[model samples]
Target chain A: MITKHLSEVTTKFNPFSKQAKTCRIFLATLPANARQTMKINSKVLPRDTDAKSELKIKFKDGREMQFDPDKHSIKDVAEEVDRHSRVLNRQAELAGS
Target chain B: MSPRLGICRDCLRKIRSPSSSTKRYLAAAAAATATTPAAPPSFEAQPPPIARFPRTQPPSHKPPEFRKSQLHRQYTSLLRSTPLLLLFQHSNLKSQEWVSIRRELSIALSKVDETYPQTPPLADSTKLQIIQAGIFESALRIAEYYKPPPPPSPGDSLATPSSSPESTNATPDPSNPIFTHALSRHAHDAVYKFKNAHPLTPLLSGPLAVLTFPTVSPPHLKAALSILAPDKQAGFPAPTRRASPGYYDGAVQAGVAKMMLLGARVEGRVLDQGGVQWVGGLEGMEGLRAQLVALLGAAGANLVGILEGAGRSVWLTMEGRRGLLEEEEKKE
Candidate 1:
C-alpha cells in the first residue's frame, strides 16, 4: 500500500480547527443549554478504539451519560439534564419553605 | 324712582341711550375735570369687565400635563415578555418555571383583551410565539437548575472563593480573583441561556403591523421556528432579508422574543450589598459587542421601532468601550 502524501493528510485534518462534525456533535452531546448549567469535566470519545462511536459526558456531580449525537436528537440530552435540574431545584425550594 | 337711589327710569335712560349716555358721561367728566384736573374718559377706551368663573372660565395658570407619546411609552417601558420572564426567574418553584411563562402570557393577553373593551382575538402568530418561548424556557429551567458546581482550580486554594453561585455549597470570599472570574463566567453564561430561551411575544406589535424581533439573529430565529413548527419552517422561505413591517408574518415574532431576551440579559449586573457593587472583569465583552451590533442593525426596522431603539444604549456602550482584543494591538 502507498503511504499517504503530507498535503492529503493535512487537508483531511487541520489540527488548529475543530470540524463541523463537532457542530453536529456538541450541538447535541452537551447542548448549549446544559453546557452553561452543568459542570462538564470532559466530552471525549472512549479509549476503546473498537467501541462504536459514542460521546462520554463527565459531570462535576460524578455522574456520566453516553450517547451518539448523530443518531439521537439533542432534546434527549437536554431532557435528561432537565430531569436532574428539576429535582435539585425542587429540593432547594422545599428546603427553603 | 328716587334720584338718590340711582334707580329711576330717567337716570336709567341717561345710561341706556347712546347719544344721551355720551352727553351725560361728558358732563360728568367735565365736572370731574374741573375738580381733579383729569381728562375726559373716551367711552370706547374703557376696558371690558374682567372674566368671571360664572359666564366664562378664569384664565388658568395650570401647566399642561406632560404626557409621553404612545411610541415613547412603548420604548421606555419593558416589553410585555420582560415581566413574564422575570416572574418565572424569581419563582421559587422549578416545575412552575418550566410551564408558567405560557400560562402567564395567555392570562395577560386575555386580561389586556378584556380591558381594551374591544377584545381582539389572539393572533395565531402570538399563540405560536408563546408556545415556542415556553418550550425554550423549559430548557432554560433545566440549564438554570441542573448545573453542578465547578471543582476548585489551583489558584483557588490560596483563599476561599465565592466561585459557586449555589449558596448552599459556597462560603463567599471577596478577595479571590478566581472567585471573581467564576462569578463573572456564571453570570455571562446565564445571560446566553436567557437570550436563547427568551420569548418574543412581549415585544410584538401584533400581526397587524409589520412584525420582527430586532434582538434575534436570522439563523437562530430560524432554528426556533423549526423547533416550534417544523412543517412551517420547511414550507416557508428562509427568513434572511429584513421583511417590511406589516408585510410578512411567521416565527419572526419568536425571533424578536429571543432578541428581547438578549437585551434583558446584557442589562443585568452582579451587585454585592456589603461593599463594592460590580467586581467582575468584562473580559469577553467583544462577543457581547458583536452580538449587540448585529442586534442593533436588526432592531432599527422591527415593528416596535421605539422598543428596538432602546437597544441603541447597549450597542453604543459596546461600541464606545474598546475591546481587549483591539487594545492589544494599540499596546504593542
Candidate 2:
C-alpha cells in the first residue's frame, strides 16, 4: 500500500522535458482520431517520456494549448491520463471492499 | 325796452331748462342707486378646516381557557402524587402490574395538558422534578419486582418477628436516596437490579458487576475466586491475575512487570512515599505497602528489589536509632 502511494507521488513529480512538451503540443493539436491513436500507444513509449503528457495528446482531439513550466501547471497532454489514473485508483479502492 | 324784453325771454327759457335738467339728473341718480348696492365689508377670514383622523380601539386581553388552567392543576397534582404512587407499586406489584401502573401514571400526567384551562407554563424546576420523579418511580417499581427474595433461614436460626413500621419507613428513605442523587444513584440501582434479576449467573458473575458499576474497581482475584467458587480448594494456589491461564505467558508478563515498575518509580516521586511512612498508622502503612508492592510487581524483580532494599535499609536505620534511645533511657 505504502509503495503504491509512494509511486503515485513519484508519478505526480515526473519531470517535464522537450519531448513531453512536444507530445503535449501534438496531443493538443491532433484531431480526435489522431489523439486516440496517441493515447493507445502511450504504454509502449520510453519510461523517461512523460506518460501523462503522452496520454493526454492521445486522448484529447487536436486542440491548441499553452502551459508554463515555471507555473507548475498540469500539461494539456497529460490531463486525460491523470484523470483516468484518479478514476482507476478510486475504482480500485472501492473494489478492495 | 326791446333788449329788456329779449333778456326776459332768455331768462324764462333758462328757468324751464333748469327744472327739466334737474328732473333728468334725479332720474339718473335713482337709476345708478338701483343698479349698485353699497359694497359689503369683508369680515375676518374663516380658518381652513382641520384634517380629521379615524379613531382606533385599544387591543383587548383574553384570559387563559378553563381547560388550560385545569391541565396546569393536574400537572402540579401529578408532581406531588407520583412518588406516592411509585411506593405503592413497589411494595406488592409484579412486572406486569408495575407496567400497568406506569402506563396509567403517564396517561394521567398527559391529561394535564389535554384540556384548555389547565395550561400553566411548565416551569423548568417543575419539569425537571416531573422527569426525575418519573424515572425514579419506574426504576423503583422495576427494582422491587425483580429483587431476589431474602436468603433462606439457616438451620437452628431463630427467626425474628418482622416489624412493619420500621421496614415501611426505611424502604421509602432508601428509595428516596436513589432518586435524590439522580444519575449516580440511578447507575447504582441499575447495577443492583441487574445483579438480582439476571438469570445467567456464571457468565455474569464477575464481568456483569464490573460493567454495571463501572465506577467500582473489579474485586481482587482472590476475593473474586472465593466469591465465585462452587467449593473451597486445597492449598493457597498462586492467584492468577487474569481468569484465563497462560494468557500472559513469560514474555508478556515480563514486559508488563517492567512497565509496571517503571510507572511506579515515576509516580512514587510525585506521590511522596516518605509521607506515607511518616503517618505510621497501620492503615496508612498497609495501604502504602500494598501500593508499593503492586507497583514493584508490575515493574518486575529488578525494580521491586531496588525498592525493597531501600525500604529494608530505612527500617534497619530506624530500628537502630530506637534501640539506642531505649539503651540510653535504661542507663539513666
Candidate 3:
C-alpha cells in the first residue's frame, strides 16, 4: 500500500454500512507501527447515521487524494496509493541520499 | 475291502427305498415340527446398545481435525458460555502492544474485583480473544437460532426402544438424526438460510476481537471500558498516571489506540455501542433489583393514596349532609 509515502490519513465511516468494508480493511492493512510515523484520524459514525464514508490521504511529497469508500474497493485504493508512491520512489532514487 | 474293483458293496449302494408306512410317519413328524414355534434362542434379553462412538465425542459434520471446524466448535461453546461480551475491531497491533494491553486490562479488572470481595473474582474468568469472524458468526447463528429437541435419555430409550428404535442404533453417521450437537448437519442447515442476516452481522466483519465476562457485572464492564476505550463522556475515564503508571506505558497506549469498540452482546440481545455504554452505566444486578423495588414501592404507595382519597371524599360528603340536616332540625 506504500504506507511510507503517506503523512496523514483521515477517515469517517458508518460501521453498519456494508460499503464501508473497504475503509475498514484499508485501516487494518496499515503497518503495526504506522501510528508512530503517520497521523491517523478515524471516526466511527453511529449506527443510525446515513453519512457517506470518506478516506483522505496526504503523501510525503504534498500530494493529497480523497476517495469515496462506498465507490472504491480496497484494491482500487491500494493501486492508487502505489501509483503515486512509484513516482516518489523514482524521484528519491535520482536524488540519491 | 470288497473283492470287485476294490470298492465296498455298502458304499456303492447303501440306500434302501422306504416303505409307505415309514414315509407317512416321517411326514407327520415334519408337520409337527413346523406347526410348533421355535424354542427361545436365548433366555437373556438384549444387552444395552454397543455404543459406536464415545458419548463425549459425538460425530461432527466437518472433519474435526481442521482448524476451522475446531474454531467453529470453540466459538459455539464461547457464545453459549458467555452471556455478556463486548466486540472490538482491532487494527494492526504488535504482539508486545497486545501483551501490555492485556496486562493493564487485568490490573484494572482486578481492582474492580477487590471492591466486591463477596462475589467470585471475575477478572480471572474474563478473556480477550482474537477470533476468526466468519466461523464465529456461524457459531453465533447456531447458538441463537438452532434449538434442537433434547436428546433422548438413555433410560428412556432403554425402556421404550420398540417405539423409538433408531435411538438405539450404535453407528456414528453424520446424517443420523439422533445427534444434535452444534457441528451436526442439522445445526448447519438450521442456520444456513439466514446467512449474514444476524443483527450483529456488520460488526462481525473485519479483524475482530471479543472481551468476554463470566457474568454481566457492570463494575467489571465499566473498568474494562475505561481501560480499553476510555472516553470520558461515556463515563469511562482512563486511569491517571499516578494511579496506574503502567497504563501509561508506550505499548499499552499504542494498543489501546488501535482497538475500537464496536458493540456488545448481552444476554442474547445484540446492542450497539450506545447500548453497550448504557449497560456499563448500570450498577450491578443488585442495584437493578433495588431500582425495581423502589419503583414498585412508590407505585404501591400512590395506589393506596388514591384509594384512600376516594373513600375519604365520600365520607366527608355524607358527614357534611348529616350535619346540615341536624342543624335544620334544630332550627325547626
Which of the numbered candidates is closest to the native, going by highest lDDT? 3
List model 3 lDDT by residue over B261-284, tens digit each: 888899999887788888899988
Clashing pairs in 3: none
Show how many residue pairs clash in every candidate, following the order shown.
Answer: 10, 26, 0
In model 1, the runs with Cα more than 4 Å from the true position are A1-52, A59-61, B1-332
Top-scoring candidate (TM-score): 3
Residues A1-97 of candidate 1: C-alpha lDDT, one tens digit per residue:
1111101100011111222132232322332233224432322221122334344544334455565544545456556655665665676689999
The residue pairs found clashing in candidate 1 are A37-B147, B81-B202, B199-B257, B200-B257, B209-B246, B210-B245, B210-B246, B213-B256, B215-B259, B216-B259
Of candidate 1 chain B, the 10-residue stretch with the lowest lDDT total is B270-279
Query: Which ten residues in a row are the worst by lDDT in model 3 chain B?
Result: B165-174
RMSD of 3: 14.0
Question: What is the C-alpha lDDT profile of model 2 across B1-332, one tens digit per residue?
Answer: 53666668667777667777798999999999999976555655655433231122111111124443333334333433332110000111233433333333233233322432324321111121112223333333333333322333543123432212222322323223222221223334544544424211211111011101111111221221121211123221322545434323443222211110000011112111122122212222335568999887778977778889999999999999999999999999
Per-candidate TM equals 0.16, 0.12, 0.75
Candidate 1 docking band: incorrect
lDDT accuracy of residue B211 in candidate 1: 20
RMSD of each: 34.9, 38.1, 14.0
Off by over 4 Å in 3: B1-56, B153-178, B286-332
List model 1 lDDT by residue over B1-332, tens digit each. Answer: 45667688876876677686788999998998789854468644766443332322211112113222222223223232222111111101123332443343344334433444433334222332221233233333333432434656667743542333322213333333322221223323434445433332222211112122223222322332222212232342323335233112333333222221111221232111110101112212344667889898887657577776679878877876757657887998
